[model samples]
Target: MRKKRQDFHFTGENNMIRRLVATLREYIPSNRGYPLSVDDGFDETALCARLEERARKGEEASRMVRLREEKRLGELFEPESIVKHNLLKMVCIDEGCMPPYIVQSESMGGNAGTWGSFPCVGANFIYDRMGGKIEHFGNIQYAPRHLINGKFAEGTFKLACKIDFHSIPPSTQYRVVKTPSFTPATDIARQALEETVEQYNKIYGINLLR
Candidate 1:
């Protein structure tokens, strides 16, 4: 009588090898930009040789170290950062064009039980002082509510942003205040405003308000 053939089942070890191969396949890039295929099975001899070579090279990249360096000294700016930079300069516009105005006063305040709106204005005054060349000025008003712990201040003039002297360019970028003479142009305009307010009863006269 012929003996019954012994049955063989490749179970746990086979499964582990299959799983590793599947994982390697998944890790490989498949996009058109990075072509990789799974048909290249791992060669234990080649891998051992490669491991020895790599160990001898003693070179490896540390992602954490690279990240820390970037955090400390990254020169690149995010889109938001660039936008805010331009906003602070008041020169952000399409295709980098500057508005011809100077920032004068940007303040914030509000009353009880109500939020406040922001009002911004720029004027051409500084340029006129420099041989009838019209310069510009600006003012921003807003009200934001915040306080120590739980109580908000009422009707307090908080300077939201203050640019002692700001000049808007013909293009959308800010140039620093040039010359001591140019530096005081806005101050002169502000003085002129003060004079007008004193001469008249209104805080902002029609000529200066615009």
Candidate 2:
């Protein structure tokens, strides 16, 4: 039988250093790779040793290449990036509240709508502000916000959220608060919200209000 070469993996420190340097070079940006900073020679040896140690700890060369590719792709474009103004909510849903009112078209009020079903009908916060502050509160009211069946679908449904205006200590008497206000409606916010809902439906494979 022929003896196999022991030098196949790495026979000495020189081989290890060579492998590390090659791997580092392959990750250089001009090679169409990730933004790995170039070595200025001062910490090269230490960095190579650390990388070799990582490799010994099961981080393979192929995995490093894959990571560099992923980093490059992420830098180029990220999947499912939020467009900021795409979020929609009118009020904050309190965690401890029971049976929070859900907003939907009157057409979806019957037993046919699945949004009222388990998991889908649960409590959710609808913030009026981008950072989720400034919650709107009041009776569940409907405005001619959008249209569905008509030529111009300007129908809207908003839930009236109950909150205490003033609470006196040691008393259960809670004064009724006036409804909170949202900013003047705009086409951009509406469009972003609609698109976000469509995206959510596509991702979860669920049918929200048509």
Candidate 3:
């Protein structure tokens, strides 16, 4: 006997992912400039040199100023964390997710006001594999830490993810499917998700399978 085919439509969560992906596509080209690598192209010496140059030019010398300056300079050098923070803010506002808050730390002394939280719910690309294992990529809830004033500094809330957005294909679709009960509701939904992933993977010359 032949099997029946299922029709799929984007669930509310999946639709949100789609929007987030779209926003990323629009934002990356102009803002990020290039793909991120293992080191994320971070160069402490170069960053310090640039900061020193700015200081010599009489730019604001506050610790927060320096931090923001580092963030701007690292836009291309350390794109992952910076890009993650940027996308998280945009997605939070667009999806009405929890607003990001600034973290306070006495260790930061007067610069505590510069730290910001990372509080998004899930990965931008999530799915369930066979045998009930859940997999995901491009998390929105990642916080990047830096050494400020010789102190190892971090935000108020910190969440970590293995993969960053720059590592994933630009055309990659975003979802939040999980195992067991949270899997796609219908066969159509499963097929749609699988097909989208496959299509983008082939086009972008990458494999997302595990």
Which candidate should be chosen as best, given lDDT against the real structure? 2
Which runs of model 2 end up more than 4 angstroms from their true locations? 1-123, 128-184, 207-210
- Model 1 spans > 4 angstroms off: 1-75, 82-84, 87-89, 93-100, 103-137, 141-174, 178-210
Report the CA-based lDDT of candidate 1 relative to the real structure: 0.29
Q: Write the per-residue lDDT of candidate 1 for residues 1-210, one digit (tens) a residue.
A: 533423233323445444544465456666543433423433433444454444334223233433443443234334333222322222321111123222223222222121223222322222223122221223212222211111211111111212233456221111221112233334553343333223222211222122
Total clashing pairs in model 3: 0
Q: Rank the candidate models, highest lDDT first.
A: 2, 3, 1
After superposition of all CA atoms, the RMSD between model 2 and the true structure is: 22.5
Clashing pairs in 3: none
What lDDT would candidate 2 get against the real structure? 0.33
Candidate 3 vs. true structure, TM-score: 0.18
* Least well predicted 10-residue stretch by lDDT in candidate 1: 152-161
Model 2 quality (TM-score): 0.22
Give candidate 3 regions above 4 Å deviation.
1-122, 125-184, 207-210
**Model 3: lDDT of residue 47:** 41
Clashes of each: 12, 14, 0
